[model samples]
Target chain A: MGKGILVVLSGPSGAGKGTICKAFLERNKSVRLSISCTTRAPREGEVDGVNYFFTEKEEFEKMIKEDKFLEYANVYGNFYGTPKSYVEETLNSGYDIILEIDTQGALNIKESFSDGVFIFVMPPSLDELKSRIIGRGTETEETLNKRFSSAADEIKLAEKYNYAVLNDTVENAVSKIESIITAEKCKINRIKDHMDVLQEV
Target chain B: MGKGILVVLSGPSGAGKGTICKAFLERNKSVRLSISCTTRAPREGEVDGVNYFFTEKEEFEKMIKEDKFLEYANVYGNFYGTPKSYVEETLNSGYDIILEIDTQGALNIKESFSDGVFIFVMPPSLDELKSRIIGRGTETEETLNKRFSSAADEIKLAEKYNYAVLNDTVENAVSKIESIITAEKCKINRIKDHMDVLQEV
Candidate 1:
């Protein structure tokens, strides 16, 4: 059998990527979601390794120097990166890994792994996006404006990704994500590799 | 919402393309199978305009001259071609169309309608392909051998397809074909067109 695929998914804040990711995991057994490692202090009710593999800043920087991360970024004085070991372990175990990272992190990961399948999720419409953000009711008007402005910039980066999905409905979006993983598995290169093994056998 | 996608599938004899197409249509409700028109005489129990649109050779040649067929060719002294009108009518009615055509016909269709998704199905192995060809039990040993020889040449052409699915198992193969269609719908160009329309609104 051939190795599993590395699938990277990204979208703007209000695009419902998280919901679709959860739905996809519930339906598909072959996918493994990649949990990120963070150098930030854990907050209340957050586990050390569940929400994130929390690490000290010194340890994070040391690993960075040692080339242990697939991609790392500093946000608001907190360092976050995808651990290389976990990904390799899951992929080697024959489970395809799903990395629900942001656009910048997706780009960084792509820089390291050229063959990774990158997918971008989009909101059905700008007005629908605003409605979703407002529906959250956690942010102030000013903060909501910031999110909307950031969405425009993020959608532009979507053009750089390998595939783009429209989040028109939760079911539709998750179905597309699942299908992408299936299609990536059926790629000629990967299938050829399987045939090579059969030939040898 | 935009229209559904059109997929053109082709593979060598005994490659299990027919089985995959059948399973895919059973699973996906929006897909419509395209029946090709041919000048060849229908075999026993074959229904007119169902298995194929059997027509006179002169009529087929006339349609070719009129550019009515999207792709047409002469095979075994009989003309076969996809009619453009029926495909367009079904597509305009908001259904995806699957064309189970030969590699040459697929390439010809791709030339004019570049947006159609093309997939090639291959057998798990060369030995398995021979077994499948013989398993049909309809073809004589001599004819099966001829087809097996041609399968080697067809496998080479499989590289030209956008996606190559190995018909290792009917269920798994169907899942991949369904995935290809689902993933193609999530393409940025299609979503971007929707977003553009919304922006105007």
Candidate 2:
């Protein structure tokens, strides 16, 4: 079997990126979603190690100074970062890692790690995207509009992504993601290690 | 849908590239195997367009001089080349093109065209590869060993390929190739065109 692949997923909020990542993990047993460390207060029902590796501001800053995160960003005054240790541990253990990150963070990760597959999820249509944002019921009308406008700007940057998976349906999106992982492993560079062993025989 | 992808496949003679390509095309109606323009006399029962596009040496040379062929080579004193027009026509017609070319031709095509996937097919194991070559019964013992030695050298060049497909089973190999074509269409650079058009509305 070929070594594992690193898949970085990004999309505008309400594009159902979280749901697709959950489905991908359910279908692929060998995949691990890298749990990010955040400086934000954990909401009710969120576990320390399960939902996120909750950290204090000072600790987060320390990690930053140490260059411990692959990429980090501040959201609403709270810092969220991907720890290099967990992702590396998962990959070294023969499991692929999936990082559900934002577009900026995805770009940063891609710059540092050129081999990671950067996928940007897309909504079916702008009207449909607006409807989904409204359906979330977690924001005001103005907030929803702001998100809708942000998606437009972000779509411009999506051209830099390695793949764009449209969330027309959950099932279809998950299928495309699975196919990408499978096809990526078959890439010549990733599987070249096996050939080196084959030559000795 | 985005423009169809062009995949150039190459491998050793007994690596089962033809079998894998045929099975893959059977499952994917969008994929068309590129037929080369050859100066060699057609074998018994080989159709003109199906087996190869037979051409006179003068016409073939004229195409070469006009820089029409993507890549051309002389094999056994007979010239064979992939016509750029046929491939471009097929792609423009919205069909994915698959060329069953050799390593040398595959490299030349890769250098000339930056896009399109380059897949190098290889047997699963050396012993298995030898068995497949021997089963063909077209070569004597001495020639068989020579061909086997050439396969070793060719596998070393697998580094130049975009993907290395192990032809362990026809069904599995075909599925992998089909998956690759499906995955390529989902690439962000390709799918973003449709999204860009949608955003304009």
Spell out the clash pairs found in candidate 1.
Answer: none
Docking class for model 1 is acceptable
Assess the local accuracy of residue B62 in candidate 1 as a C-alpha lDDT between 0 and 100.
Answer: 89
Candidate that scores best on lDDT: 2
| Local error of candidate 2 at residue B82 (angstroms) | 1.3
Off by over 4 Å in 2: A41-48, A56-59, A65-67, A140-146, A196-201, B41-46, B55-59, B62-68, B140-146, B196-198
**What is the two-chain DockQ of model 2?**
0.49
B1-201, model 1: which lDDT tens digit per residue? 677677988888888887788788888876888999998778667799777899998888889899899999876467899999988888778689998887778888988988788898877788888888888787767777778778788777766777888788999888788888778776666565655523533
Which candidate has the top score in DockQ?
Answer: 2
Error of 1 at B83 (Å): 1.8
How well does candidate 1 score on lDDT at residue A117?
87
